[model samples]
Target: MRIGLLTEGGYPYATGESALWCDRLVRGLAPHTFDVYALTGDAGQEPAGRLPLPPHVRAVRTAAPGDAEGGGPGGRSDRCGYGRRERGRFEAAFADLAYGVCAGDVDTGAGPHADPAERFAAGLYALAELARAHGGLPAALRSETAVRVLESACRASGARRTLAAATLPDQLAVVEQWERLLRPLSLDWYDASDGLGRVDLCHAASAGAAALPGLVAKRFFGTPLLVTEHGSRLRAHYLATAGAPFTTPVRALLAAFHGRLAGEAYRRADLLTPGNAHTRRWQERCGADPDRLRTVHPGMDAERFAETGEHEDSGDPATLAWIGRVEPAKDLVALLHAFAAIRRRQPDVRLRIIAAPVRDADAAGYLALCRSLAAQLFPAEAAGAHAAGESPVSFEELGSPEAPTLEDAYAAGAVVVLSSVAEGFPVGLVEAMFCARATVSTDVGAVVEVVGGTGLVVPPRNPTALADACLALLRDPGRRHRLGAAARARALELFTVEQNLAAYRGLYLELLSHAPVRHRAAPGVPFAHPAESHVPGSWADRPAAPATSAPVKATATTVAAAPGDPDA
Candidate 1:
């Protein structure tokens, strides 16, 4: 089947969310042709180029959100003002969105009859149609007309107090952001033959902006849409917009837009695959049909850690290891504090903070802060720490001599530690599981789901709970071994690439079975006739009266007139 893989700020890019796993999935399901429709974010991700793709990926069409603001020279989006009629259309569609958001008409758990969601979708698609017909929105959405519509909506009757109180600046800010998020609607990917219309299925690798193309494809071409969310898009929007220097009006507006979009995506998608049950619940709460939802855990390559996983003996008996990026969300400071508490109980134990290479300035600063905290907590001269220039807390890279590979990093610890205050799939935790290492993780995001009772989970940011959990695992070798074995078993059965591919392979065929066959030939779109192979009837059960009819064998004329013969 031809799959249109839709992604945002990831996949094909060297960085971004869902890139690695999506690559693994595309590589694994190589039999199917993929046409990637990727929307990159504001970071100029295209400059970084893309990851090497397998041959099955027929096309990789990458566009940045920046494209929405332009049409190059002599194009429709050349900062040319919309015509009077075009202005009317733009205003009406923009008003539907602004009014829906302003009045708080967004519904999280509503059916198709829900007017709020209906209006949101109607407005979204209307704008998409306008872009398709007019070449693109360009400056229309960022024009004064849009801001006027938003201001009018805020002051309209039944609008929320927070939105109604929005100032001019707030309206402008919201308009700018709204235009940014709506970039997908203005893209050239809406072409019927060369774009998403040609694909059999639209596999949206994410929701929100990434899924917008799939929504359009399904609407225009009857394309089957499959949306997969490793993390909840609406929830992420809420988290990102909170305390983000925006007024309540801006925040509420952003949240409402994302909520409405997510609800629409859930309602229209043929299937919704969340990476974990935690994400599944988020979707359900956001009005996704329970029947359409499926949980597909993120998959990793197990063979990378196979030798280490199967080994009976690996890693230091007295060490706890933390492996992941050094970000504030990872809560390295909390982990250091927890290690301080662990040192009080067992002075001989060591804590290793193995971080992936970080490029962001903020991440570098956060890493530096963690190192400083570790120093203050465990001074070099401290008697209880490891001897001979070794501190109790050590920060090292994954490829360093001491930890040559990811497996080596996991192997350096008897118990893997995850101290993130926020997480998605807990990939590192699963990697540790694959390496057959016992774990102590914070109970946040999908940590509990991934751990699944195999490892100890403590509340986030609680040094006491974290320290206690680590000590328990460290002190009991037999318990540690049992948990490690169980974790490895679970990771192998559920989190490996093979299992993930198998699940998607089945899901792909299942979706196609229900979808109408799409044809490229000139006979025109035909009936939705399904093969009746399963019906219990003589048609299915009867052996041929072939022997009776065999006497009427093919004559020369009949043979000449066979289906494939050119001449009769």
Candidate 2:
């Protein structure tokens, strides 16, 4: 089946979260054709170049967030150029949607035109079509014409009083926000010639920005969309403070719009795949049908750390290793306090906080704070400690020559520790398990779920609890060995790329079976195209043949299992 693989700043790009997983999925499922529609965060990431494309990926198209319409904050006031009829329709549609957001009522009156949710969807499509027909909506929405239309809608009954009373600055800000929010509508990706309109299904790698294009594609064409959220996009955006600088009213309004869009996407999708039960719960709360949701954990590459478990820990096994990006969210402060408690119990115990250098500003600041806390925790220096190279707690970067690589870092200790106060998948925990290291993780994000019964899970922000869990593994060598072995086994079975590929291979077929195809070869192509172009036109009409004698490498089906027909 042809799949429209939608992503934002990832998969195809060397940088970007979830790039590795997306690459694995594409390469693993070579039988299904993938057309990639990637939205880049900036022009700098473009220089990183693209990842090696597998045979499954038929094509890739990219655009950037920085290229969104209205290059300047002041350019939105020009609207004299739009014709009267088109301007009126555009303004009216936008105003109706905006009113729905301002009033916080999806069902304005339950009618097609008045229903707020329907109005928003219809208006979003109208704006997209308008942009397609014209050059784009950058200048149009920024225009005074758009503002006047919004003003009229706000004054109409059933609209919120605050919207009607919005100051000039508020009006301008709202218009600018709308332009940014609707930027996906202006992208040139909704035509039949492009792979988007021809794909059997659109599989969005994430929700929010990455999924925006999928929504647009569905609206433009009758394409069925499948949105998969590993980390909740809405939650992540809220946590990351994407547009926090805006006024509360503006933020709330935009939030409502995103919520509505998410709801609509969930409502229309044939299926929703969330990476964990935590994320799935969020989807359900946001109106996703319980029946349509599936939990699929993101696969991890486990082969690299296989050598670390070759020997059991015996040499000065007092080291506690913490591996992950050094961010405030990881709660290094609490970790330091926990380490101090461990030191009080076992004076010889050592703690190593291995963090990657901060690439982002927030993380840089957080790392500095963690370093300061470590200094404060281990303030007293022994007279001969400098020569002996001994410190109770140490902050080290991942690539330091002393440890060299991540595998070496993990092998430094028998126990891996995760002190994150906010987490999604706990990649660090999985990496530790791959190295056959027992883990003690704070209860956050998917930590408990990922660890399952293999490791000790403690409550977040409790230094005593965290310290005790670490001590349990530290004191009992036998327990550590057993837990480490079990953890490794679990990760190898469920989290490895091989298992992930197998799950997705089955899901691909399952989705194809239920989601009718929308594409077909031209008149001159090999087989008869199904009326529903997404279906295999010839496969539908053919009688079942005896098993095939040759293996189909793409499907991983063995030849010996089937006998007779060439194309079974």
Model 2 C-alpha lDDT versus the unseen true structure: 0.75
| Tens-place lDDT digits, model 2, residues 299-415 | 887768878855546324789988888777888899889999999888889888888866888888888787777776777743346567877777788889867898888998878
Error of 1 at 467 (Å): 1.7
Native-referenced Cα lDDT, model 1: 0.81
Each model's total of backbone clashes? 0, 4
Give the distance in Å from residue 537's predicted Cα in candidate 2 to where it truly belongs: 16
TM-score of 1: 0.87
RMSD of each predicted structure: 7.4, 7.1
Q: What are the per-residue Cα lDDT tens digits for candidate 1 across 158-244?
A: 677788678999888887888778878888897765788777889998778889989988888888999999999888888887769
Off by over 4 Å in 1: 69-80, 106-114, 380-387, 522-568
